[model samples]
Target: MTAQLEATQVASTQLDKNTIRRRIAWRVAQEMNDGDIVNLGIGLPTLVANEVDKDVELLLQAENGLLGIDSLALEQQIDLDLVNAGGQHIIAIEGACYFNSADSFAIIRGGHVDATVLGALQVDKYGNLANWIIPGKMVPGMGGAMDLVVGAKRVIVAMEHTVKGKPKLLQKCTLPLTATGQVDLIITEIGVFNITQQGMELTELAPEFSIEEVQMATEADLIISPHLITMPTPH
Candidate 1:
């Protein structure tokens, strides 16, 4: 690369919010295993779909009853009647199926969902999650988060390292609980963590951040992994 082009790239660095979110989504996409039946929560988690490995065969299900989701539909290809759990337009693959809310929840609550990716307001050392509601604020009622966390075989929290510089990974959640002792893993712009019987483990660090920086951004105690890896930035 020429010096001028390198300078242009540096000057065009994405705003932190966009950078972190895209990084989290891309990292989460890599965590999916072939043949897994995955449920994606709204917002950042939905972004994971487009980043999934093309060769990986996994079904994406939305709580709103659509399954075998192919991708988020382009504006031109959108069907008026189809959408994901977040009400965002999406494309359903050939074998896609739709059902009533009853059957949808049945698929999740029946323990058929292999994994669920969700965003959280807070995650604690004990694998507890709080993402539903904040005190003294009017908001949409907690959707299916509680059920998803409880019912899915694996719960993954895909969120930024912090909320506007405030640590969202805490020693204990300060907000209303979505589920307790449920989250299996967390992916953020700064690192990847796993909730283990011993506690939260920092298994990987982003190439741009130091271990000290990660700890400073987290309120939960971290058990550093023996085989820590550097997380590559998404192109």
Candidate 2:
């Protein structure tokens, strides 16, 4: 291919990736309810903070003992001490409070948190999550994920449809499990899956992708939702 064509392909790929991430974040944000206390895990899940509607009364929780997080914009000066679980600088909203890790874990493990958005390495059809370890690959140990997953009323996963062209949505998670059968919902670049007693249901799809494409990319069988619809994309 010509240099111009190669450049175009690279730009297109980047744009696609960005669009996918934004869509996943937006969908996860829509799941938030007014006055809900939510914890957002590191990585892709953190992006949901930006997509949340300003009017929504969500109290963002950080595992490191901060609550009611208000993410700062690019131009804002970040306070070194005010960081989320991902260690990204953030601002505290009105009524925000802080405590020690003991209190934080109490809030999480005691089931006070309404919801938690997390990113996963692999999620099986049975809603099993394997996010902490990737076999031989070195990774930060699973922090409060296990506690949060079991404690939160709702567990939503936000991640890419695939990793390095390999499917992350699988028949069975090959990686070590973080929390077994705990995922309530999953938002990926190509679609949304709702985990029910029956199994993973494909409830929504990206406009640019087809059901066949999604099925092909997914390793597990997907139950098509009767009310399947196109996913909302960024304008």
Q: List the RMSD of every prediction in angstroms.
A: 6.1, 4.4
Model 2 is weakest, by summed lDDT over 10 consecutive residues, at: 1-10
For residues 1-235, what per-residue lDDT tens digits would candidate 2 score against the true structure?
1432333333346446677778789889999999999999998888888999999989999999998888743546677788888788888887899988899999999999999999999999898999899788887799999999999999999998776566788889998999998999999877899998888899988876677777777788889999999887767
Stretches of candidate 2 off by over 4 Å are: 1-15, 73-75
List the candidates' TM-scores in order: 0.92, 0.92
Question: What is the C-alpha RMSD, rounded to one decimal, of candidate 2?
Answer: 4.4
Candidate 2 is scored at a TM of: 0.92
Model 1 over residues 44-86: C-alpha lDDT tens digits?
A: 9999998998999989999988779988999999998999988
The alpha-carbon deviation from the true structure for residue 65 of candidate 1, after best TM-score superposition, in angstroms, is 0.7
Candidate 1, superposed: residue stretches over 4 Å from native: 1-15
